[model samples]
Target: MPRSFLAVSLIALALAGCVTKPRPPSHLGATVTVAPPSKADVWQRVASAADAARIARIGSAWSEGLAEARSRGFGDEVKKEALLLRSGAALARPAPTPGSYSCRMVEIGSTPKKKVAFERFKPFFCYVEVEGELLTIVKQTGSQRPAGRLWEDDVASRLVYLGSLALGEEDQPKAYGEDPARDMAGVVERVAPFVWRLVIPYPRNGAKLDVFELTPVTEQPK
Candidate 1:
């Protein structure tokens, strides 16, 4: 063969070998590790102190108003005030004490072995008290703001209490429904010193339930 032709063929063969060589197995080769998703990945922390205060104020005001109306014999005025409080412009609550906590809703994947997935229908807020019951506020609809009426209307928020913590039980709102008497049962487990998990049963049978991992945005000294 001509020298030039021989050289060209050698280069071609080398290029072909380079192109056809199999890549090393990824497990045996250098690999990139990905961190698994955790509660932090899904749950959003509520950082707005003002928002927390506002919710607190609304709850307080509603309680006060209800008591006053009952004492003064002001019928329907309590309802009127509740309506006003919910529809009126924003109002601020007093600053939350140091150690108070607030939480925001987070989206997460459905549990692995369930036939159905539970859908979170509204935004939720949790307030941790230093010495009393833990307060939770859940909106009935996306349009509802964190106001007195929203608190009053939602059974979940209105009835949430930490009394079960003493008994080592999960506290949830009273389940009220038709003949079958559907109610939500929840269990609270401590994942860490500052992290907790809320496990609630799905309303429908054959559905995958979701567990909410809660992290405190504000931690008070014990």
Candidate 2:
């Protein structure tokens, strides 16, 4: 071989040896010491496309749910809970005191396929606790419990909620993205003194709005 050709081949080999393979974004498919996705990151993967859309357009839930209720002749019922049901009723300092709470579920609105425009379940027990940089809410008494963290958002008066349902006697529920059917998303706000509501729009159960009102349980002297 010519000296020049030999030199060129050596240079090519050296360049090839220096090349490196790119790293995957998620460290995907690498099982050993795999880094689990953060709770904040699973919202997109776990929530259904339609549900995500509903969360994105949460502003419409008030008008739409109320409209559905009024259309079905539930206006008076809605008017009765005016403060808690208002769309922009969130107050400043939206954080809730960490303690047990009395929670209730109110479902409003329906598609033509179903006739349930408004339904309110009896009060149940829930608990709020501090979790790292977020606050967590867990339904303490119910066949279907909701548990999730409250994330601070750009909005001033509300915190975004990303959670999943815990069924039966499960100790720890699957993470949000682990099950699409279990994933739940909503916004938490303080609508009245010592009162907050978690409003979920376009709930999978066919309701346009599913509001959970939470009020702290007063501590009594032992």
Candidate 3:
């Protein structure tokens, strides 16, 4: 592994997060101290066997998601954001700094027999927090938020996200496996300078791919 990537990744905290906890200030630029991971990788240790299996097929999800989106007439739009939509556009140093971020969601490809192929949601606020040797990215705004941790992978350019949705304003997010219906899985990759995206492929909801673009915010909501 490259020294720069390894330095950032080795300290990335992984696992799920809750809304009520008093987490540290996740501001950007400070180096965090992390306990070394055990012999088994973090994802392999924490992810449910079934979800792990699904994430393993992320490659297929991207392939099919793009194909269906184009078939449904979103080819032009998909082509427009090639960097964010492309499956292999991941850059190095997938570890994200702990901080508040501006997040936007865009969906591509409709499920079979569905006509709603492309969709975009207004930008929202998300947060990245670290605890132990893992990092959690959770949508700080929006009633329906996905929260999960980033785990290292052999692929090098991306980290696996295993988390669940926090429905409503007060409901705590179910852990990645507590509720099979709400489980969410994806890959977190840096697509550009200080910008990262979480791509949830083969999603069970509105579309095939749920792409969320995340950029750190200088000012956070009070």
Candidate 4:
């Protein structure tokens, strides 16, 4: 073979060898790579199976706590709070103006970090005047996917029970009267990003319900 051709063939063979060889895995977690070339060569052992199990447990605990709260007469409070947290007080209960308004929690997304975090969703509502001027309002909440559905074996099925329990607690007096939010306020505050409340509005007219979301004002950046 000619010297130039021989050199070219050698380069091609080297490139082929490089291409055929499998690359080693990185030290990062199972997420493949955090930086560029975000592809998985091999799943990393960032967290143990136990860790995943625990993470799942945390979500389960949250759901359980919510259920317990419902059983404790905080049903309206919890749903309203979820709505408030997902939406806002202004839109949630409104000012109780003569114009009738009805609001409810559309979605609740929470992110439970080690110390602090957030969960945001939407509070969808329909407000109408006695005269029949109806309006539907959908408010946007912040971003935070909190851990709550760990035990939800069936999202759709459990949601029915959850919806009934979370939203409707009229017959279940014991569940409706207990204040789960108030009971878990301290625990939630310790782990949650802000001060959480399980507010059962005064007078108990049952016409209005909500969970008041309160966050301590942080020092503004200079």
lDDT of each: 0.33, 0.85, 0.83, 0.28
Tens digit per residue, CA lDDT, model 3, 1-222: 899897776555332332357667768557999978752366778877777777778788788878877887889988887788888889999989999999999887776667778887899999999978989998888889889988888778888888999888756798878898899888899999998999887777857688999999999966
Q: Which residue window of length 10 is worst by lDDT in model 2?
A: 39-48
- Superposed Cα deviation of residue 82, candidate 1 (Å): 42
Across residues 104-191, which tens digit of lDDT does each residue of candidate 4 receive? 2212222232121122234322222222332111111222111111111212211100000222323221221144331111011111
Shift of residue 83 alpha carbon in model 4, Å: 4.4
| Cα RMSD to the true fold for all candidates | 17.6, 9.5, 22.7, 19.4
Best candidate, lDDT-wise?
2
lDDT of 2 by residue, 120-184 (tens): 89988888999887799998876899999887666768777888999998987778768888888
Candidate with more favorable, higher lDDT: 1 or 2: 2
Per-candidate TM equals 0.27, 0.76, 0.77, 0.21
Candidate 2 clashes between residue pairs 3 or more apart in a chain or in different chains: none
Off by over 4 Å in 2: 1-52, 219-222
Per-prediction tally of clashes: 2, 0, 5, 15
TM-score of 4: 0.21
lDDT of model 1 at residue 188?
36
Give candidate 3's error at residue 221 in angstroms: 2.6
